[model samples]
Target: MKIDIIKKYNDVRTATIDFCSHLQIEDFSIQVVQFASPAKWHLAHTTWFFETFILKNYVKDYKEFDADFNFLFNSYYNSFGDRILQTNRGNMSRPSIDNVFAYRRYVDAKMQDFLERITDEEVIDLVILGLNHEQQHQELLITDVKYMLGHNPIFPEYHKDFNLIKDQNTITNTVKIQSGIYQIGHQADGFCYDNELGVHKVYVDDFEVNNHLVTNGDYLEFMESGAYSDFNLWLDEGWSWVNKNDIKAPMYWHQVDGEWHNYTLAGLQKVDNDAILSHINFFEANAFAAWKGMRLPTEFEWEIASKELNWGERWEWTNSAYLPYPNFETANGAVGEYNGKFMSNKMVLRGASVATSKNHSRATYRNFFNPTERWQFTGIRLAK
Candidate 1:
């Protein structure tokens, strides 16, 4: 079992590297948008994670893959020592794209060797968890790359035929959930991040959630009806955010000749009215829910409803902060630093986005980001 788990880890890690090879050298450094990272940095960072955690700790007499990598790729973990400055990640041109790929190969080789010799299940589980963590980054790689490329005036395509046609709207379904007690958070049976566990109970009032995400057409109606201009429809904070940011529409959306177009990795494309509205932050999502005379569901309601729905193409923003559960305990050592520190000042998002890894998402999975963050593939599901 240990051998097989390690092999799976190696396979997934190798695939991550392969995904990077799809991008051009020029694509690796284009961090034109503040919210997105350069693709090259992501490649190096994931490799740095394995080297710092498993190789440096578990491997016998393991040597550093690159001495400078400790400074170059460490992200936000003050416990690991002073990290590379966040904003300057785009400025790193010394290693070059080729050298970053080389760094990945070196880490991969060492990780495979360590995996083969390590027989402990605890070690195997950590490695598996690390691999999945890397896979989450893999999805972020695509989303970040998409955001970067979409910012270019020339508008490059990541792939020649990667366009997905908008699906036809079928039945407009609504699920009227009777308010009752429901269990929220993860139940540990398989691999899960620390923030997800704790079999806690919560009371939910009777609410009606839209069977699907609010679509582009639905949002357009709100815009046409002056949703952004009406201060009464928005919360004080949300209206302030809209005024401060001059948020007239969702990010990446532009109006040309009274028609809406969106910037995509494949260049500028017409907004698909049938598709769900994405790239809106929680503030915008909440305001829209208010405009519709509905309310955003709490995280508990989201988890309960999601357990029975098919979550695809959208991640629902819930009215909950990313906080530690009751009787919460952090895992010992560096991995403990993973989820606990960011528990404050972040909102929870349920379901997985279109860019999410198939194996990495589950109903119990909890994704969080600051309410102002809109660069992610974020959207909203309406609830009452």
Candidate 2:
């Protein structure tokens, strides 16, 4: 078991570097929005996570890699101590790209040494959590970099091999799930976040959900019907968002000479009608659903029907608020600040996406984002 864990650790760590191999040094610091972080920051913060959480606790007399890293890389852990503001992360021109890589190598060496001798199950659990946490950042690294490059005046391809929008929508039928009291949350005997811990029953009414994710072609029809201009299809808040931002289309979408195109990791290309829709926020997702005279499925419905339906092409927005499950409790300490603190004012998204790492997503995995966030690979699934 220990050997397997160590291999998984190396695989995840190496994967992070491999994902950034195509990125230039300039790309490492491109963070156009406050919500999205830079690739260099992600690399450092994930390393800091292992250094602070695992090594500091398990390794006796562990030497500090750099006393300043604790302040530079601490992300939202108030108990962990003061840190740089997130918006100011892009302003960090220091800690040069070379320094970040050196930091990763320094900490990874310590982690490899610790994982080999550590026999405590509790310590192993923290190591696993750290790996999962890095996996989350791996996805963010891809999406955040995409957001930066996509917004660039001259959209440049990150890599020709990186085709993130190639997944085609498969299921075309609506799956019927009978109303019942169903067990929700993570019930499996495996690693899961505290957010998925409160295993409880939820009563859902009979509803039909589309097995197929909404495709770009489908959304094109919505756009042709002038839904964006029609305030009736949008919720009160969604309408205000649309008008305020002049949001005529999904993020990264552009109309060139009356032809629809979108930016992908490989660069800008004509929107593929058959490809699954992506980069849409909850507001646009809800409005698109309403335009079709349907509604977005609740997270419960998505989970209940997930087994039978094909998902994972994109993170499907659910018509559910990000809230704690019954009997949910935040873990103690700085680690406790992980998911519980951000439960308010965010909507839940179900399934995985093209950028999600292998085995990183499960049926019960709950992804939350502000209603207006569209930089991530988010889409919609219709229900009634």
Candidate 3:
């Protein structure tokens, strides 16, 4: 068991490094927006997680690679200690990409040594949590890189053949889920986030959801109908967001000579009408559903119907607000800050995306983001 886990740890850690293999040295520190983090920070921060949570707790004589990194790379665990402000992550140019790589190597070496002889189940659980945490950053690393490169005026390609968008034919068919009392939350024995821990019952009404995802062509009709200017089609807050940002279309979408083009990992390319739509937020997804005389599914509905649905191309927005399940509780320390602290003011997103790390997603995985945040690989699925 320990051998398999050690191999998994090394594999996941190496995979994160491999994910950024194609990037130029100069591309490592770009952070265009406050929400998006620099690639260097992500690399160091994931390393910092293992060091802070695992090595320090399990290894008696483990030493931190750099004492200052406790503040430089710590993200949002106020209980853990001081951390740099989220907006100022781009200012961390002092770490130098080489230094960050060295930091990862240092922690990885220690983690490998610790994993070799560790048999404490508590320590093992923490190690698994750290690995899952790193996987989450791996996904964020992709979106953050995309944001930095997509916002560049030159629209540079991260890789010539890297495609994050999956091409699929339009399917207008719907799957009807009958009303029933269903058991929800994570029941599997494997690792899952704290938010998915409370196994409980939920009553869902019969509803129909799309067999596939909402396509660019389906959304284009909404755009051509001038729904961006239509107030009644959106929620009151969504209308304000639309007008405040002048958000006429999805993020990375550009209008060229009356044709739609979007920035992809492969650089700017013409939008495929039949391709699945992505990079959408809950507000836009909700508005699009309203325009179609439909609604976004509650998280429960999405999970129950997900057994038969072909999803995994995009993180579909659910109408559910993020909250604690019945009997949900947090761990005793900074680790408790993982999923429970930010439950308020965020919406639930279900399924996985093209950029999600391999074996990182499951049916009950709950991804949350602010309604206005659209840089992640998010999309819509209509329900009625």
Candidate 4:
């Protein structure tokens, strides 16, 4: 079936706005910490992406929308020009929330016109990249919003739709994966990031992986076992982070009145034990694995084993570092900077989370984060 480019573009664009519909005007620009961008900044930056890349490059006689936005919204594209500091995204209140929405509408109108008239394959490919980029940001906007709302002492609901489904995952059942030469990276005909290229063969050793994600109940057991104070279970850097942050529990988790409570999209509530664990950093995941006398799965092992297990509930952290495949080549142009630039000193995560946009991930997809970063929806699955 031919992908409906126009409909996909519109669906993705509408989804970003819908994700923020419940926000207050004050909520639009809140950046609780440096790693996340403001909700309003995400709105403009995604639009700026389309305008700067697709419309300007492909659309003939395209006019730039407010020349100053280039500096304000260009995220980490040093080749393009200087970018707004990631930590200062919250300070950009001049665009105003309403004007940001207007900016989205303005670009959407032009994008539709360009899509309707364009017949070139290369430009359509770029448009596909833009839609995927927007989808990635769509997930970020939700997580960043959750972080904003969660950290507030007067915790507010982003929306009141917390219908969490029960997950019946086991801590005992282990699926034994036999050793074989398996292929990794994106090989099928479909949309994937540039980092997923360099498709090649790899030898995966026999391994045993749990069938279900590690749940909150499981993590609670780890916590109650005095895992936090034990330096034996932690890496040197992780111990330092634990001591520095005065860490006790996962982000958004609190012990109120001697009972465990977690902040959710529907506001703070009693923590559900059955739900899979989230908001844990790579360091925590690794330490927990060490405490259990188990380890995290490698990225190749994860891709091969993902078929039979239930995933997509949390972004599972892999033991593998975020590096390119063998003999991978970076593309030429601004798009070249997409995934190649961030391949060092970062751990790779496989699978998606509840916050991921529907139909946005695959088994081979690789997500990476710094070892200390934990504000996003990250969790662990065990291997041996």
Q: Flag regions of model 3 displaced more than 4 Å.
A: 169-172
Full candidate order by lDDT, most accurate first: 2, 3, 4, 1
Q: How well does candidate 3 score on lDDT at residue 367? A: 95
Task: Report lDDT per candidate.
Answer: 0.80, 0.92, 0.91, 0.88
Q: Write the per-residue lDDT of candidate 2 for residues 1-384, one digit (tens) a residue.
A: 889999999999999999999999898876799989999999999999999998888789999789999998999999888999999899889889999999999999998888889889998888899999999999999999998999998999999878698689655888999999999999888899999888899899999999898889999999889999999998899899999988888899999999999999899999999999999999999999988889999999999999988888899999999999999998889889999999999999999999999989899999999998999999889999
* Model 1 regions lying over 4 Å from their true place: 164-171
Error of 2 at 273 (Å): 1.1
lDDT for 102 in candidate 3 is 96
The residue-by-residue lDDT of candidate 1 on 75-120, one tens digit each, is 7777688877778888887798889888988888898777678887
Q: Model 4: per-residue lDDT, tens digit, 109-206?
A: 99988888878888888888988898899888988888888888988887777523234465456789999899888988888988888889999889
Residue 102 displacement (Å), model 3:
0.7
lDDT at 209, model 3: 92
TM-score of each: 0.95, 0.99, 0.98, 0.97
* Root-mean-square deviation of candidate 3: 1.1
Screening candidate 1 with a backbone cut-off below 3 angstroms (N, C-alpha, C), the clashing residue pairs are none
Give the backbone clash total of model 4. 0
Candidate 4: residue pairs that collide: none
Collision count for each candidate, in order? 0, 0, 0, 0
